[model samples]
Target: MMLSEKYLQIRKHSEQICEPLEREDYVVQPIVDVSPPKWHLGHTTWFFETFILEAFLPGYQVYNPAYNYVFNSYYETIGNRVIRTDRGNLSRPGVKEIYQYRAYVDAAMLDLLKAPISPKAEELLLLGFHHEQQHQELLLTDIKYILGHNPLFPVYSTTAFKLHHDQTKEREMISIKAGIYEIGYSGTDFCFDNELGRHKVYLPEFSISSNLVTNAEYLEFINSGGYKNFTYWHAEGWDWININQISSPMYWHLIDGVWHTYTLAGLQPLAVQEALTHISYYEAYAYASWAKLRLPTEFEWEVAAKSFDWGQRWEWTESAYLPYPGFSKAAGAIGEYNGKFMVNQKVLRGASLATPEMHSRITYRNFFHPQLRWQFTGIRLAK
Candidate 1:
């Protein structure tokens, strides 16, 4: 597809997510798990305008110069952004004005996409397309998090990501012998900067589960008083649990003492075969240890994932997210993608249903804090 067409579709997907939401729902926040919908809409526009249009388009006009401050997310290279805590207070721009801001930029972006001449410009446009998809996932996640806080427990859509029955079964355990394995994405189409610089790392011999740990399996963990007992948790995990007084994953709640998960589609009985998602890396690790298993190293995960449903869910790994050997970043603000975050985070392989089909790949390394479980995070086991 031409870059313009692709961007149109990409931008549309971001809007499509809002079809089920009302203006009143735009600013909801149950917890820290979500950004306001208005924020997401405005932020993605800031991405293209701040990063691409303002840099390359001659005489490009910003809809509201103040938005440059208000919506500029975290790119410090680009002046100042409106403070995050105040995102909920921007009732002046409201929802309609934000859409107008998006529409104005969408027109300018299409103009620039057509006027672009250099291969570098084209590549960056593709990067923006993927960047928008990332936000589309965030849009759903943030809304779910916000709705989760509300007593009504609103449902966004009924489309299911998993089957009604638990079709996932335990297959023969595959043992990978100790050796060095190549890790990271090597393809050339487009990737987050973090997935570059393919490198090798040593992995110990280990047995990994055939499929993700299912909701049914996790129910066993909960029924066994998994949250009540700190013995199965790491010290940090214990602290996180206590500090937050966390009983389960972010959206999980008890109804008549039975576990039900809240989502964009309201509350439902947890799908038994679907991977048990929204657990932190600390929780994933603790749960693995409880099962007498360990989280797979990223290298081990990259290698084993090549043979399974690597696109289904974000698979947690034991390794902290770090720069690869011989890794170097691109020059300038575009470099903001990944070079800075090469510390104190665990890598999750694969992608979730929320991820655009285009961006999902085996070697894509998504990282988050060990104690964060709100994204579409889940677990696979290593023994």
Candidate 2:
């Protein structure tokens, strides 16, 4: 299928999902983990309107003047943007209104895609599609994060999930050759800026676990006083836990000494064999240290995942995310996406359960601050 046709379907379906919600739900951020659903709807449209439509559409009309500022998410070159932490404050554009706005843009975008598109405009449109997909994934994460805090703890969707335990015995740590390993995307397909120019590095002789750390295994950590022992945690992690008086993963609850977790499908008993998720790098590092293991460096992770499917949950790695060696950012504001986030965060390998299979690939480096854990993050331990 042509990229344009597929994107149109996704675009329309995205709007359809929010149509059933009331005006209030669009802005019901509830906390920092969510953006107003209205904002997500419009901001995604703004990407096409700003990056592709404005540049390509003849006699293009800017739908909302404030949209440039309101929808510009994290593009430093694009000037100031609406505050992400305060996304709930946006109430001027009601939920219904955003859908109308989306409809107008969708008609225009489809029209443009039907006509001839310049190479630059076409690439931007493709980028816009993937950008929307990212937000689509975030839309789920953000809504779940918000609903988790609600007193009612409302369930968003009634879709059933698979919770069956895969009884395959855990594999022992497997050793891969520790020679010089070239890591990065080898294909010409679209990828984020971080995974550029396959490069070489000397990998020390080490072994990585065949699978992710399970919920059952993590239970052992808690049983063994993992949080109570300061030595198992990083200095900063310990301080964060102490200052916050942290006890367990964010979504976990201990009611009368029994464990449970909240999910989009509603609260359920925590499954032990399920991959441990929504964990910060600090906590992952600490737990690995406790188990006499280390998180694989991003290079090592790429070397390992290069053969396996990188479409699973995002794997926590030992390397801090940074620009590739001899890498240069693409020209224009789009360059802001990956280059700006190159510092103060660790690299993650593999996709999450939330990510679509089409978007996941080796050398796709996802990163977050050591203490942040709002997404599906888990560890693949190494020694």
Best by lDDT: 1
What would the per-residue lDDT of candidate 2 be over residues 1-383, giving only the tens digit for each residue? 77668877778656655544545567877666568777888899988888887889898887887889888888888789878887788777776777788888888887887867788887787788778878876776776677777767677666532322232455667788869988777787787767887788998887878778877788888889998999998899999988988778768887777888887667778866777888888789888988988898888777776444344467788888888887788888998878877888888888776764377777778888888787878888888
What is the number of residue pairs that collide in model 1? Answer: 3
| Clashes by residue pair, model 1 | 69-82, 155-266, 156-264
Worst 10 residues of 1 by lDDT: 160-169
User: What do the candidate models score in CA lDDT, each in turn?
Assistant: 0.79, 0.77
Task: Evaluate model 2: give its lDDT.
Answer: 0.77
Error of 2 at 360 (Å): 0.5
Query: How far in Å is the alpha carbon of 242 misplaced in model 1?
Result: 1.9
C-alpha RMSD by candidate, in order: 2.0, 2.0
How would you encode candidate 1's per-residue C-alpha lDDT over 50-78 as one tens digit per residue?
77888788999878888888887777777
- Alpha carbon lDDT at 140, candidate 2: 65
lDDT value for model 1: 0.79
User: TM-scores for all candidates?
Assistant: 0.94, 0.94
